[model samples]
Target: MKTFKLNPYRIGFRTIKTAAGMAIGVIIAKQLGVINFSSAAILVVLCVKNTKMKSMQAAWARFASCLMGLIFASLVFELLGYYPVVLGLIVLLFIPATVVIGTQEGVVTACVIILHCFNSKGVSLDFILNEILLIIIGLSIALLLNLFMPNRSRELEDYKTNIEQEFQLILSEFSEALKYVDIKLDHRMIAHVQLTIEKAKSVAFMDVENHFGRNDNSYYHYFTMRGEQALLLYRMVGLINNVSRSDQLHQQLSELIHEMSQNISGHDHTAIRLHDLYAIQLQLKDHQLPTSYEAFHSRASAFQLLHELENYLHIKSKFGSLKK
Candidate 1:
C-alpha cells in the first residue's frame, strides 16, 4: 500500500530496452507485418503490473491516447495528402497534441499514429486505419498474455528472509548499543533502527497480502497469529530491560533463535508448539539485568526475535513449503 516516486531512469531504460526489442522483432517479421501494433502493446501490459491499483490505469491511458492520435492522423492524411505542407502541419500539431494528452496512454497512442504516418506521402487514410487496427490487435494480445501469466510468489519467501535478516540486524544493533552503554547513542542510529522496524512490520503484513494471502484456507489462522506476534514486538519495544540480566538474556535469545530456526521446516509443527521453557538461560558474563532502559532493551530484543519467528512460521504455513 505504499507509493513513492517511480525511478525514472530505471523505467526509462526498461522502456527503451522493450521498445528496441519490439521494433527489432517486428522488423524481422515484416514478412507477415502482423505484429506492428500487437508487439507495441507490451507497453500497456507492463504498465499495468507496476502496481495493483495502477495496473489498468496506464493501459487505458495508452489506449485512449492512441485512439486520439489515430483520429488526428487520419483526418490529416485524408485532407492533406502527403504534401510537404500537410506533413509539416501534422508535425506541428502532433507535439502539442501529445503534450496535452499528458499520460503514457496518450504517448503510446501518439507513437502509434506517428509511426503509421511516417512512410506516407500524404495523410493516408489507409495507413492511419491500419495503425489503428494493429493497435487494437496488439493490445488484445498483450492483455491476454499478461492475464494468463503467473505473477511471481518469491515475495513470500523474501518476506521470511527479510524478517530473519532483520532479527539478526536488530540484535547486532542491540549488541552494539549495549557495548556503547556508556556512550550516548547518535540520534541518527536510533532513527534508523526505528525506521527499519517500522518498515519491517509493514512489509511483513504486505507480504502476507501479496504472497501468503488469506484466501488460502490454512493461512487464515497463520496470518492472525503472525499479526499478533508483530503486535507483541511493537508493545515489547516499550518493555526492554538492560541490566545484569542482559548477558544471560542474550545467550538465551541466541539459543531461542537456534531452536526456532530448526522449526523452519515445520515438519512437526506440534513438536515446536509443545516445547516449553524457551526462555533465555545463563547469567550475564558477570552482570545481572541492567537498570531501566537497559532492562527494557534486553527484554525487547528477545521479544522482537520471537516476533520474527512468529511471522516466519506464518509464511511457511501459508506457503505450505514446510517440510514436515
Candidate 2:
C-alpha cells in the first residue's frame, strides 16, 4: 500500500467572520421578537465580505434595497390587492428600479423582503416595520463583526517575498539556459509567478481599502510594477525558448542575465543596471552579423532580451523613486 499526502484546504478568515456574524444576528433577532428572524441571518451571510469597506457598502445597499422593496410592495399590493399577477408585476418593476438606483447588490435581499410580504398575505405597517428591523439587525451585526479588520500587511509582505524568490529562481534558470548549462526548463513557473502577482495585488488593494484618508499606496504600486515586469519576463522566456544553439553571444547574454538576477533585489542600483543594458544593446548592434541563419536568429533574440531587460530596470527605478 502506498501512503498519500493530502493538500490542505484552509478556511479564510472572512468566511469564519460571516458565519459568526450570521449566528449573532439570528440570536439578536430572536431576542428582539422580530418575526421572520431567519431573514436577519440571511442578510448577514449576504453582506459580509473580505474587507470592512466592502461589508459597509454591501450593508448600505441591502438596507436601501429592502426599504425600496417594502415601499413598492405596500403600494402595489395595497392598491391592486395581493395576487399572483401582482407578484409578477412587482418582480418586473422592482428589479429595474433597483438597477436604476444602483442598489443592484441588494436585489436578492429585496426579493426576500417582497416574498415575506406575499407569504404574510398583505403588506401592513407592522409587517414593514418588522422587515426593517430584520435589515437593521443583520446589517448592524455585519458592521460590528467587520469593525476591526486585522492588518494584512504582514501577509502582503510574505507574498512579496515569495514572488521575489520565485523571480530570482526564474532569472537564475534563464541564465543557466543561455549558458547551455541546463537543457530542461519548467515553463510552469511563469504561470506560478502570474498567480502570485495577482494574489499580491489583491492583498495590497484590500490593505488600501482598510484604511481611511491614507494616500500611501506603496504596496499596491509595488505589485503593479511587478505585474508589468512579469509581462517582460514572459516575453524573455519566449525568446529564450527559441534558442537551439549557443555561441559567444549566448555567453555574454548569460553573464548579463546573471547580473540582472543579482540586481533584481535592492533595486537601488537599477540606474547602473540600465546603463549596462544600454551598453550591451549598442555592442550587439555594432557587432558583425553571423553567417548562419540560426546564429543570426539567436543574436536577434538576445537583442530583444536586452530591450526587455532595460524596460524591467526602468520599471524598478520608477517604483523605487515612488518610495522616496
Candidate 3:
C-alpha cells in the first residue's frame, strides 16, 4: 500500500484569501442577525476566484442569479403554495433563466438561495431582507479580499527573466549541436519555453487586471512576441537536428547562435543581429551548392535556420520598440 504524503506548509495565496474572506463574511452576517449565516460563507468560497477581474465577474453573476432565485422562490412558494412539487418546478424554471442571463457560474449559489426559501416554507419580508444583506456581506468581503492581490508586475518581470534564461540555454544548445553531430538535443526545452511563455502571458494579464486606468499593452505585446519566437525556435531546432557535419557554413551559424544567446537580455541588439544574419544569408548564397543527397539536405537545413534567425531578430526588434 502506498501512503499519501502531503505538504502542510504549502498554501497558495488564493487559498489564504478565500479562507479569510469566508471568515469575515460569516462573522459579519452573524453579527447582522442573518439566520442563515453559512450562506455568506458559501458565497465567499464561490466568489473568490483566481484573479480580481474573475472574482468580480463571478460575484456579479452570483448576485444576479441569487436575486433571480429569490424572485422565483417568492412567487412559487407564495402563489403556488410551498410543496416538493413546487420546488421541482422552481428548479426547472430557474436553471433556464440563469443560463439565459449568462449567470451560470452562480447556479449552485442560486439553488442554495432557493433551498433557504423552501426551508422557511415562504418568503417573509424579513427573510428577503436577510438574503439581501447576506449577498451584500458576502460579495463585499470577497471583492475587498481580492483587491488585496500582491504586485503582479514583479512576478511578470521574474517570468520574463526565467523565459529569457531558458531561451539562452536553448540557443546555446543549438550552437553546440551545429558544431557536432554526437550532441543530443533535449526536445523538452522547446516545450518548457512554450509553457513558460503561457505562464508569462497569464501573469501579464493579471497585472493588467490589477490596475484600473493603466493602458499599458507592453506586457501583452511582449508575451505575444515571445510566443511567436518560441514557434520559430521550435522549427529551428527541428532543422538543426538534421545537420550531421560541420563546415565553414556550420561554424559561422554556430557563432551567430552564440552571439544571439549572449545578447538575449539586451534591448537594441536586433539591428546588429539582423545585419549579421543578412551577411550570413549572403555567405550561404555565395557558397558552393552541394552535389550529394545528404549534402543537399544539410545545405537546405542551413538556409531554413538562417530564415528563422532573421524572423527571430525581427520579433526581438518589434518587442524592444514596444518597451519604448
lDDT per residue for candidate 2 within 1-324, as digits (tens), equals 999999988887778888898889999999999999988989989988777778878998999999999889888888887898998899899999989989999999999998888788877788888999999999898888878688887888788888888888888899888877456565588888988999889888888777767656888888888889888888888787666555456776777778778756576678777777777767765666778998778777777777788888888887784341
Best by TM-score: 3
Clashing pairs in 2: none
Candidate 1 lDDT over 1-324, as tens digits, reads: 888876645454334444544554344335446435444545443453422323345556666777776677667767767565765677677667766766544564566455566455455456656666566554443343334323334534454455545444543543444344453323343344445445545433433343322433222333344444445444433333332233445454444444544443354662453242232222333445456775656665655644554555454445554221
In candidate 2, stretches whose alpha carbon ends up further than 4 angstroms from where it belongs are 1-9, 181-186, 214-216, 241-246, 282-286, 321-324
Candidate lDDT values, in order: 0.48, 0.82, 0.85
- Which candidate, 1 or 3, has the higher lDDT? 3
Using lDDT as the measure, the top candidate is 3
TM-score to native of every candidate shown: 0.45, 0.87, 0.92
Order of models, best TM-score first: 3, 2, 1
Q: Write the per-residue lDDT of candidate 3 for residues 130-205, one digit (tens) a residue.
A: 9888888998899998888877767777888898899999999999999888886756899988998998888788
Candidate 1: Cα lDDT at 57: 53
Against the true structure, candidate 1 has what lDDT? 0.48
